[model samples]
Target: MSRGTTAVIDFDNLRHNFNVLKQLAPSKLVLVVKADAYGHGLKQVVQALDNVDCFAVATIEEALTVRKYRPKTKILLLEGFLDKYELKIAFEQHFDSVIHQQEQIQMFEDFQTNQVMNVWLKYDSGMNRLGFSGDEYSRAIKTLENNNKVNELILMSHFASANQKHNKFNTQQVEKFIKFKTSHEISISNSSALLNHINIADEWCRVGLALFGVSPIEDKTAHDYKLKPVMTLKTNVIALKQIKAGETIGYGQAYTAKTNMQIAIIGIGYGDGYPWSLGNNATVKLNNQQARIVGRVSMDMMAIDISDIEIVDNITIGDSVLIWGINANGNLPLETVASNAKTIPYVLLCQITSRVHYQYVE
Candidate 1:
């Protein structure tokens, strides 16, 4: 077991979480594999969730990537019909669309053929990043229906604060969606909505982080539910050194030991998608033993305090080290780790750059 890196993903756990989410909503479960299954590996994660009904993606290429695996899964394009090729692919590939921006309306009209194209009118339920509102939404629905092009219509909206169960905004958004989609079915639910906003699970629950077994709200761990973490982020230790007092480690000299201390350099770092904002004190579990980061995390390395581990020198240089996810205490759940870093789980998972290997475990 080398010291420098470890990322352990549990397919069984991921599947369990997905099942739990499906049981929560009395509607279709739309597994979201966007951002490469939140950096846990796209095809790898999809294979684990073969039982799911559909998937959602942000771009055309992302949808295509998933199509390579589960070719027949119903895919809904949240961003909806962009390029001319995207419009053509939507019909040919049978991918659905969540038409939000006005331009998307023209996208459907310009399409060579809308024979099998299914469209969802995305409404502004609160989170204003996308979707139409008020007269714009009403008109969009009418335009699509009037054109006699779209074969299917579903109402869609993103919740802004479903994580906050007490937030009145969730109720407001639900009301708005009901009024907007009165004549159509709908797809609503992000990770937060499934766990905390059960009251409005709606017809289609877009399971994302929830399926990976992570909580949507701050300070809320998935352990509170029956969910299990799907990814176990692990790394290996590459080197060990005992530095004298006043010695600094890694780049930027972020930590200067006050007394003689032992440090362990880990293989995985920010470049591998480990969050940098977690600071030097971030926790690590090596050989099921707890350790702490002591120096600034470099692009490819992390230093940890290992003076307390028994038989420290006997430990080989390539021992496994957990960067995030379930450890001795239980699932670290990437979404929770993201919150601690003051970011969203979607970004934390998607930021997992490229060229990473995924080892599947049932």
Candidate 2:
């Protein structure tokens, strides 16, 4: 049999998470399908959730991809059109664009089109990354409102620290965003904001990680919110070896055995999108037993200490290993793996390389 390095995408789990988020959300849901639906497969996800209120992406191409599958559903460009040509395409595709800068406004004014476009006016608020300053933001609202080319106008802002439930900055940002609110619809809550119960009444919520059955909140797992993991990454043990107490394992000889130990080399590593930085304290589920990682992770494989496993002798080559997700034993939350890798779940999911095969299940 071939190496069993695979990412299983459970559409049922995805739908369940969507329904859970819908119940928690105050109003409309703008499902963020950017980064290929957080590397779960964009086209598949867009088609699976055909009845969602809207699908938001980071690029115009991603929006077009969603439109290709769900022709009638609303698609939004989070970054908006970059130039006159993109602006034209947005109007042609009937995509909602976010106007965050004065330059985008100027492009709208210079363009000649009979078609009207829905616009999301982004305010700087506390996050200095995008959107116009307070003064500039006010002018843009007026400009878009008066422009006959603009159809629906929605006010929006981003949260800098919504993950941190008690951060005072969230309150400050919310207060600033409220000042610009008029009669237009608004979207501000992200996955963290909604999960943290920091949402406003009837505002659109743009959820990404949580939509894919992963938690965006710190110190919490998806199960805590009754969300099931959609992606379960799995691999297999390729080789097993026994080494003496003084022997070291893998590259850099980073891990030295204090006692006689058994090691299993698994057919997955950074090349398969498993984080290279993960080792030592990091663990994987093998045959319902926790196997601690040893030495530095290589490009193709890594070794796990399985000496403590009660069934060490029973585990042979090609035994299935759970990198992260639910199995017969129990669930190994991606959140836990992320913490061990010194990164976030988003990075772990998005960084999955092409070498790893993906299997979608209904």
- For lDDT, the strongest prediction is 2
Q: How do the residues 1-101 of candidate 1 rate in per-residue lDDT, one tens digit apiece?
A: 44334455788888788778877887888888887787788778776677668888888888888888888888888888777887888788889888888
Number of clashing residue pairs, candidate 1: 24
- Residue 321 error, candidate 1, Å: 1.1
Quote the RMSD, in angstroms, for model 1. 2.1
Residue by residue across 135-195, what tens digits does model 2's lDDT show?
9889899999999999999999999999999999999999999888889999899999988
What residue runs in model 1 are displaced by over 4 Å at the alpha carbon? 1-4, 327-336
TM-score of 2: 0.98
Which runs of model 2 end up more than 4 angstroms from their true locations? none
Worst 10 residues of 2 by lDDT: 195-204
